[model samples]
Target: MAIMLYYPLIEPPRDVMYQGLLYWDMISTIVPDLADPDRESGWVRPSMMSPDMAAVADAGLYTPLSIASHVEPSVGIGGVDLTAKLRAALADLCSEMPERELKPRPAVEDPEQEIVYSDKLPPHCVDLLLENGLARVARREPMLIVSPAVHFTLLSVLARQLAHDLTAWQRVADRAEPCLPYTDQPWAFRLAHLPATGKPERCWQVELGGLLPVPDPSVPVSEVIAFRLKYNDERVRLVRAIRNLLRRLGGGEDPDEVFAELRAELADALSDLDRASQRRRVHWMRRSVSVLVALGSAAGAKVSPDYAWLLGLIGGYAVNVATTSMPSLPGDQGVDLSYLQRIRKAVE
Candidate 1:
């Protein structure tokens, strides 16, 4: 069985590329808009919010799982007839969505007493979601709940703590919050089809994907060739670790402690990946300097590291120099790990 996960909300909130690639089996998300009935928004459900997932599924990318479909409806609670109360709550929250605000409201305005949908979803139907939504999904399957949201966001261990109550069930922060590997997509690069030459570093945006590099004048052979070799080969290692961890998670029905241990082993994988990237960059810079020094001597030009303009002129087509040091990575295991912790508790 593929490892399944629920990314919070609908419409691919953020960083879905990495989220989709890693940590999923029949991967997709289906967070229900409990107030969906009230809003006349574009779509009815998460899966229906196009571009349809069918094309991706056909390509074997990943299938979208409906939150509504995966979870069972709440039955009852404490002989208090929670079913009726929850049904009532759902009705109230769904039917009572307030108008979506386009402008800021007056500060002195009185708040509406009724449960309504707004910027922040009201937790009026939270009980129903807990009993049926999150609880059922976690109990039946070990799922990962991945989200980028921080400072806002799982539960505990033994003694049969409520999935929502336990210590592991806490919205505990990740080992550390990680800034993405790349800030804004790294200039969406693509190699041009033109024959390679060493003239000048030139590139242009294609109508379709991204910048296509026509390396007529420039692009250093050493850097270009060594591009594939990042000096630090941790990506493959990390990928292997993820696969191994998931394999254990998938096929083996290990004891709770063993399972927990495996996950804990990977808890810092994100930090490790970042650290590896930092090291690779450091290697890249040092290698570039070495190449430039050799080239400068051969060309009968004195090159100094402090002359950034000269470095840029010399290395523009060649080197990617290291400027400021990368900040030390924090311990945030990422938000998903906490949800995993919650799932473990809920299932128990």
Candidate 2:
């Protein structure tokens, strides 16, 4: 149910002379024997040979050097070109990858052609992901499982979105009816299970489980809480509205008494909100919604607005809606609803 998102400001390339240093340096490393008469005896030399000759020398090594050069190389005797060593280190850091790993490279020189790895996905994968959401048949059940391919940098995006969703939900829920009577209600949260349909026979679970505090107290309490309270209140109102109908059918108890019990049960379900357990509550909020929806669908129960609330929390869209000025939201409902957007706007 939760939808996490991130919006970053990307800068395009600037117009400056590349000076072909990487080119020269790269060539120098691979074909140090090639002569350049401009100013050099070695790696420090400037190339004065005809641009054509220099180009040829550069080209001679380009293909091989491209294949050989790495992201990082080792410390050298005089800090000379160490790209090969550096690359090895990076590969090792990335789980001891072999030198032969087939990394992504464009035929033409494109700044966009950056590092590519088999286990990692680039930004370009976004379109495919969104497309799959539409055509795919509820992959891995209804849970919003975080991708292992995700990096710490990316998880930051998810954290931000989660905060945003909380804010938005607070607003909307506050505005609803029979409001939880107080803003400072203490809550305690626990994870509940919904059995899985397929072979695994289990529902989505939080990898990190714990209680958390309210992420942002600076933001104003949400208006939606009041609205939700109002909506729930209507249950009683509606029961009363049709009291005569019930009486005509010879009901045993006063309609008000019966409604009072139902209302009390609903209230009890919502009664405790332990701020001390806020972290656990938030995580529960995030993971539970997705599981519930999956369970409900499996069991054929209709989802409610509360389900939507959970989705927002799990995905971080609610935070965006809550913290951001409405204008800051994306035109697309799905994108706008991301918790990340809310965090981004709040911080921005």
Name the best candidate (by TM-score): 1
lDDT of 2 at 76: 21
Tens digits of lDDT, candidate 2, 1-348: 111111111111100001011101111111122224663332212342433324424444211111112111222222222333223223332353332222222232332122122112122232333342311212332212222222121222212222233334434556321101000101100100101101111111111111111223222222112222333343333323222222221222322344344434333322332222242232112111100101222321221222211111211222110010111211111122111111112210
Please give the lDDT score at residue 100 for candidate 1.
28
Quote the positional error of residue 108 for candidate 1 in Å: 17
* CA error at residue 64 for candidate 1, angstroms: 3.8
* TM-scores of the candidates in the order shown: 0.26, 0.16
The parts of candidate 2 lying over 4 Å away from their true place are 1-292, 296-298, 301-342, 345-348
The Cα local distance difference test for each model comes to 0.25, 0.21
lDDT of 1 by residue, 208-290 (tens): 01001111113232332233245224334444544453333223222233335644434444345446536545222111101
Q: What C-alpha lDDT, on a 0 to 100 scale, does residue 286 get in candidate 2?
A: 16
How close to the true structure is residue 330 of candidate 1, measured as C-alpha lDDT? 18
